[model samples]
Target: MKTLLKNGLMLDEQSKKLVKRDILIDGEIIAKIASEIEDEEAMQIEVAEKLITPGFIDLHVHLREPGFEQKETIETGTYAAARGGFTTVACMPNTRPPIDSVPIVEEILEKAEEAGYARVLPIGAITVRQLGQELTDMEALKKAGVVAVSDDGVGVQSSKMMKEAMRKAYALGLPVVAHCEDNSLAKGGCVHDGEFAKRYGLQGIPSEAESIHVARDILLAEDIGVHYHVCHISSEQSVRLVREAKARGQKVTAEVTPHHLLLCDEDIPEPNPMFKMNPPLRSKKDREALIQGLKDGTIDVIATDHAPHTLLEKQQGMERAPFGIVGLETAFPLLYTNLVRTGELTLAELIEKMTRKPAELFGLPYGVLAEGKVADMTVIDLESERPIDPSAFKSKGRNTPFAGTYVYGWPVMTFYKGVKTWDQADIFVTFEE
Candidate 1:
């Protein structure tokens, strides 16, 4: 099958400019790209006022499949991803059985293939059952098609265990994506240890809980020369550590979430569980630092830590409810409106972080918009505006804090592997006249 995408504005990475071009897709690969291409026999899509680019990639996400299917299934998760303009995502292994074994990884892959929306890559748990005790056969996990290993929801507390995991992962050529938190310092706290927590008399999770572990993992990775990636970075000190680590040429990379860049503990408004997360929304100062880190090249990627839970689970209230918010559907609009339109980041810069940087860090080949590359792309309408609504989300998780906020730049369509996976704008038709 052949389809022509006509008159779309695309970023030419080598030239560092946006150029208008026509893209031709033959089967599952981008066949050609030129200033203009006409094929009457092929179906065509007019993207006159839209921006076409490589599909966005999320390095951290939780599909909640293989165990927490009630929260989110692979089908629902990938549907949400495609609607959110992502073509590929790596899911965290915090499911019921946990993705620590080869069988679980295979199960996820099979489910994703059956779902057939965005490409789903499984991240295996670093520890067996994520118990932080025994390692989960790193060699076997790699062979089972896991791109990386991480115990995302909980931190691996044992220093010796983490060091050994890093060593083994390095030997097997996989990145150690760490959820940095010193459990002892964390103390079962739910909200950031800041003004809100103090005002409400709630137990606060200190910044040290996350930073201490960030420091430890960076040190461990430095000694072993393993590629270490920090997940959901929310603290100022952690950003400083990552900045210094990069300065010293350590193989370390970090990602910031849209919520962290946009919200702080002070913005919680109430004691709602929707506002809570693992690393927790931090102080205003930490939020500012996270933005600055993205501006100055300290943060490499912008990922949606799109964890989903049932409405019942979220309605359980702050103290007892789960720590997460669904983000896949709102990430781009929130960031584009607040960051790009506000002059904090250019459109090209934002797209690069969401697309190219994550792919390069993870060594995947799905984020470039060049000829002969896989035809994974997203077409976005930057001129239209809409309000954030979780009820309309494709995922089962309707737990988001951006419910009534107005935003611009919604994705109009998404293509994965040359197939139209999701479409919001009625813009495709057979070529005529």
Candidate 2:
């Protein structure tokens, strides 16, 4: 089957063009990209002034399959991803069973393949059961289709264990995505250890807790000659460390979330559980540092940590509630409305972080719009306005802090591997008329 998309602006960092063109898709590859293509048998799609770009790729997401289905399943999570314009996502292995072994990794891969929505790449756990004691079967897991290794949700406490994991992953030619946090310093803390926490009479998690682990991981990666990636960076010190590490020619990369870049602890009002997340929102200065890091190219990508939890779990008091908020459905709108529209980042740069940069970093082959590339694409209505509504979400978990926020620029349609899997209004609208 051949599909032709016309009358859309192609936004690519390498070459920005605003011409009326048609993208001819033959099977699962883009057959051609040209102006005034006369194909009488092709199905024509008029985008009518939308922006067509390569599908977004999120490097950090929690699908909660195999164990925590109540929070999210692979099917539901990928549906949410498709709605959010992501054609591929690298899932964190902090599941109920924890993707620590070859069997577990294979199970996730099989399930994702069966689900058949967004491409799900399972990350293998760095340590057995993520206990940070001993490394898992890295080679076997890699053979089972695991793209990377991590102990997300909790950082490895022992430098010895982390160094060993890095060494094994380095030898295997896989990147180690580090969840930077010093458990010793983060003991029983719920929010950022700053004036907000002090004023609320709650124990705060210090920024040093995050930066210390980041610094250690960078040095370990340098010593072991492995690729190290920092997840959900939320501290100025951590950003500074990553900048310096890059300058020193270390194989280190970092990602920041939308919440960490846009919101701060000062913006949290009255201990709301929705606002609660691990590596909790930091001070304004830290927020500024994250923005600057993205602008200066210190941060390599923008990922939606996209953690989902039950309403009952999030309803608990801020101190007792689980850490994390749903991000997939809101990431693009929040970024476009706040950052790109405000001149903080160019549209090309934003698309680059969401697409090509992540694929290049992770060694994936699905984040570009060139001919002969995989036809994973998203058509975005850059001027479309909408209010954030968690109740209308595709995922089972709707524990976001951005509910009711007005935002612009949403994904209208998403195609995965030449198949139209998600058409938002067609799939989501309740009223037939």
Candidate 3:
């Protein structure tokens, strides 16, 4: 099948300017991109006024499959990802039976291939069963098609265990992704250790909880020469530590979630569970630091730690509720409107961070839009406005705090490998006779 997309705008990387282009797709590859194209034999679609770019890539997300399928599954999660403009995502290894062995990793791959929505990259657990007791077979896991090794959802408490894992991963050419939480420091806490927790008379999770582990992991990675990455960075001190390490020329990288960038603890209207999340929304100062970190090159990528939980589990009160919120369906519009439209970040910067930067960081070839490349692209309505609605979400979870918030730059349509995956409003598409 062949299709031609007309009247689309793409950001020129070299000049950082929006340029008009017509893209032609043949089978699964972008056959041609030019100022104008005419093909009577091919079906054509008019995009009206929309921004076209490579499909977004997310480096961190949770797809609860294999054991915990109620909250999310490979099919539902990828549908949410496509709706949000993500074509490639790297899933964390925090399931009932964590991705510790070759078989589990292959299982996820098979499930994703069967789902046929988004490309799912499985991350292997650093420790067997994520117990932090013994390192998983890193070399074997790498050979079995794992991208990185991480014990996400919990920190590796044993420094000795973590160092050994780092050594093995480095030798095997695998990056070690750290969750960065010290159980002793972060344990028994609900909200961030800030004024909000104090006002609500609730327990606070100190910044030290995450920073301590970040510091330790960075030091170990620096000495052992492992490619290290920090996940869902939400603290001021952690930002400072990562900044210092990058300054020292360490192979350190960090990711920030949209919730941390878009909302702070002070933005939490009340003690509602919707506003609750692990590494809970931090102080106003920390939010500022995170933004500055992104602008100043201290942070490497922006990921949707798209953890989904059922409303029943999330409504269990602040202290008792689980630590997460659904993000895959709402990340782009929220960030584009709040950051890019507000002039805090340019359209190019946001797209660069969401697409190219992540692909380069994780070493994937799916984040570019050009001739001869796979047609994994999306068309976004940058000028259109819509209110955030969880009811329309494709994922099984509806635990977002951004519901009812009006936003712009929503994905109107998504194409993965030249196949239409998502079409908002069932927009117009023309087929030739």
**Local distance difference test, per candidate?**
0.92, 0.90, 0.90
| lDDT assessment of candidate 3 | 0.90
Residues 1-433 of candidate 2: C-alpha lDDT, one tens digit per residue: 9888887778644466455667988889999988766677788888878888899999999999989999999999998998899999999999978999888888888887887778999999999889988899999999999999999999999999999999999999999998998988998999999888999998999999999999888888899989999999999999999999999998899999999999999999889999999889999999999999999999999999999999999999989999999988788889999999999998888888999999999999878998999999998888878888888888888999899999998888888998877786753473233
lDDT of 2 at 277: 92
What is the overall TM-score of model 1 with all chains considered together? 0.97
Candidate 1, which segments miss by more than 4 Å at Cα? 425-433
lDDT of 2 at 193: 93
How much is 91 displaced in model 2, in angstroms?
A: 0.7
Model 1 lDDT per residue over 348-421, tens place: 99999999999999999978898999999999989988777676788899999889899999998999999999
Looking at model 3, residue 279 earns an lDDT score of 81
Cα lDDT of candidate 2 equals: 0.90
Best by lDDT: 1
Backbone clash count for every predicted candidate, in the order shown = 0, 0, 0
Cα lDDT tens digits, model 3, 298-392, are: 99889999988999998899889898999987898999999998899888888888888888887888789999999999999998787887877
Clashing pairs in 3: none
Q: lDDT rank, highest first? A: 1, 3, 2
Scored by lDDT, model 1 comes in at: 0.92
